[model samples]
Target: MKMQKTNKWILIYGVIAALLIALHYVLQLSVFEVWNEYVPFLEKLSMSLFLIALIFMVSKIIRKLINTRAHLEGDRYNLLRITRLLAIVSSLIVATSFLFQNLYAAVVSFGLISLIIGFALQAPITSFIAWIYLIFRRPYLVGDRIQINGLRGDVVEINYLDTTMLECSGDYLVNDRRSGRIIRFPNSLILKEEVINYSGPDFPFIWNETPIQVAYTSDLEFVEECLLAATNRDFREHYRHFAAHEWEEWEPAVYFRINTYAWMEAVISYPVEPRDTTGRRNRILRYALALLNEAPDKVQFPEGTLR
Candidate 1:
């Protein structure tokens, strides 16, 4: 398999080299003829050699740019920076080529050829442009948990064609939340889909819930107080900043209700860092249980309840 792959690559490279050589010779025969009268063969050769050298140099720079872009995985900022740099370099080259009228005319005449090439790569170019917008606007960032067009994941990379992710939720495996599978999402989706950023600048914390049940016979007010106290103790420091921020707009509160089914419902509502939600919920549950254990008889479940 490895040998076959190596041979295939060699064949492709050979074909490309042959094409480039053919193009160089064809251009030399056709274009250099006009200039041969004004410039000696040696000088023309030197100029031809320089143009060839420039093309190779540009090719090398393009390869490096592509490789550098590959490293910008999940980082929108770096991706945009690399893209802008490439655009600038490409523009400069095109502009410089225009300085030579004959060459410029020749290049312009080849616009149909360029158009054909552009048409062939329309999808990738469109995706790249969307990527540029994503980078500048920063709808999401690396490590941000987001749901876009029904796909949920932690973004792992942002590339030319697609953004890669470590899947978090959706139709995929449940409880295998830490599954190492990587997903590549096309950049074009940014234009077509609604992207929900779970960890955007404004809302870094997710609203978490910890539900507790107690007997209807328990002192309702007292259970509420105990539950609130437990929640405040376990998550106060963690949620304090967001709470304070929320307070500016609306008061933060933990809601409790006695369901019609004769169960005291203590729903501890709080904001938690999206990534730490699972662990934070566990801690809050443990604290709440400890608080309940202190008042065992008082906190007993309704008699005959299987739960």
Candidate 2:
């Protein structure tokens, strides 16, 4: 199978070489004598085609070499190494072109190429710049949960122009969780749109609120104490490291108050690890309920009469 694939590629390469040679001859007959001056535009044209083919061949060879090394040893950083190789190859190509071509010819070729590519890829260039910024700034890493332009998800991959995500909310999934659907978003949006990185440098913990309603006669003070006790006992350890790393302090508190309708409202505000915010909140709720279950009768709803 591999041999057949190799044969097919060889045939394709031969056909491409033949076509480039024909195009070169046709270009040789151009009315513009400048096209035939200096380097013979035909040779230049064929060289350009040959250079493109060489780049692809080199890329394939590098990939194969990486795979072979990975098989021999257990090197798992092949993708990063391959990307570096590509960058180096691109730089070498640019340097060689500038070195060999006459200054005037080089300038004309570069100017025309830049103008055409710039016009064709303005947005893509912007996105690529944004990707570079994200990579260097370390705003968010792969697997981090983030929200951008109102779309929330766990980042799956970061490509040249866009970052891919596994969508994590709305009708897409049960309990408003990650739906397993992949969404690709332009990196330029990171610069243009507001990005909320749940696990960023300073924001590694999510402020989670779990509100509970109780009867008017319920003791607000007792409820507050119980809630605080439950939170400190169950979640303090789980979120302590996150708080220390992100907030540089720890102060977990729960507040209780009586609303206008005389209902006791206990709002528990606690620190939760950014990655597991939802799960931690649910666990806190379970623990709070278990604590309240000790006084089930006292946890009754506020009294009211229907009109």
Candidate 3:
């Protein structure tokens, strides 16, 4: 429905542009001498409007075609931004041409103006260049969770000069949950700092571990079995895609480590999506504890001060 409405508006703009161009020729019979001065304005207006509408129509068609392929969804956002920038540039060109009688003179004047503005807005110009870099290099996409500088968030918008993110695990939260805070940083920051994209490269899931403490008297074999069982069950129930232990080193592992206290730590490590880390840890801990508690004599846990 939104696409249809946008197409309708584009059609209206095209029709009005055509009528305006036709009216320029019809104005020769307006009989009013004052109307002669408005002919040039109408001509430029019609041309600019027609060009903008045409660009939008082509972009819309391209996006509609892209919508058929699920993999190209990320590219659609980049294309939309480029189309908007193109429209703004085309309108400026038309407006400037109408302002000067000689096209060369207009070009020279705009060049000088741009040079001055470039000097005045060095940071913003660098950010715009970085935006172009982002379109091609794609260190992170719109929906990818990334960490750059000191900010960690999910990319929501990448504008010409700045990128906006929905912050996660901010000052208010200890877990890997969204903090409902908006973070905006200059696009140029990517050039100066490293960007860590959770969704990119080869591995789709990050390695996370949850550790449980057990007394020295606990049955080490039983504890390992219980942890592995809990991990396998969680994988089968929640992440069936990883049920097979054939995907490189993504399979779950149970390892023992001596803690600073008298109790030993049995840690279960598994691969999980970045967004599901907290929940996955919780589920694995709950399941592992349940299985261990069923046989308290076999798997002893620390009590009192040692716990």
Winning candidate number (TM-score): 3
Candidate 2 residue-wise lDDT, 1-307, digit = tens: 6445645665576667668767666666656456556447456657667655555545545554555555412122325444555756564564456455654665677678779999899999899888778767766667678888888888877777889888887565545377778889998998888887886655546777788888767766777877788777665557555434444454567777766666767899877766676786777778877878788666665666610
**Tens digits of lDDT, candidate 1, 124-191:** 88888887787778777777788888778888677767898898744655532545667788898998
Q: Where does the lowest 10-residue lDDT sum fall in candidate 1?
A: 244-253
Against the correct fold, how does model 3 do in TM-score?
Answer: 0.88
RMSD of 2: 9.2
Please write out the lDDT profile of model 3 over residues 29-132, one tens digit for every residue: 65645767876666566665666566566655555554445364457678778867876776676667667855687788899999999999999999999999
TM-scores, all models, native as reference: 0.64, 0.63, 0.88
Q: How does candidate 3 score on lDDT? A: 0.82
**In model 3, where do residues sit more than 4 Å from their true spots?**
25-45, 66-73, 240-246
- What are the RMSD figures for all models against the true structure? 9.0, 9.2, 2.7
Per-candidate total of colliding backbone pairs? 2, 0, 0
Residue 74 CA displacement from its true place in model 1, Å: 7.2
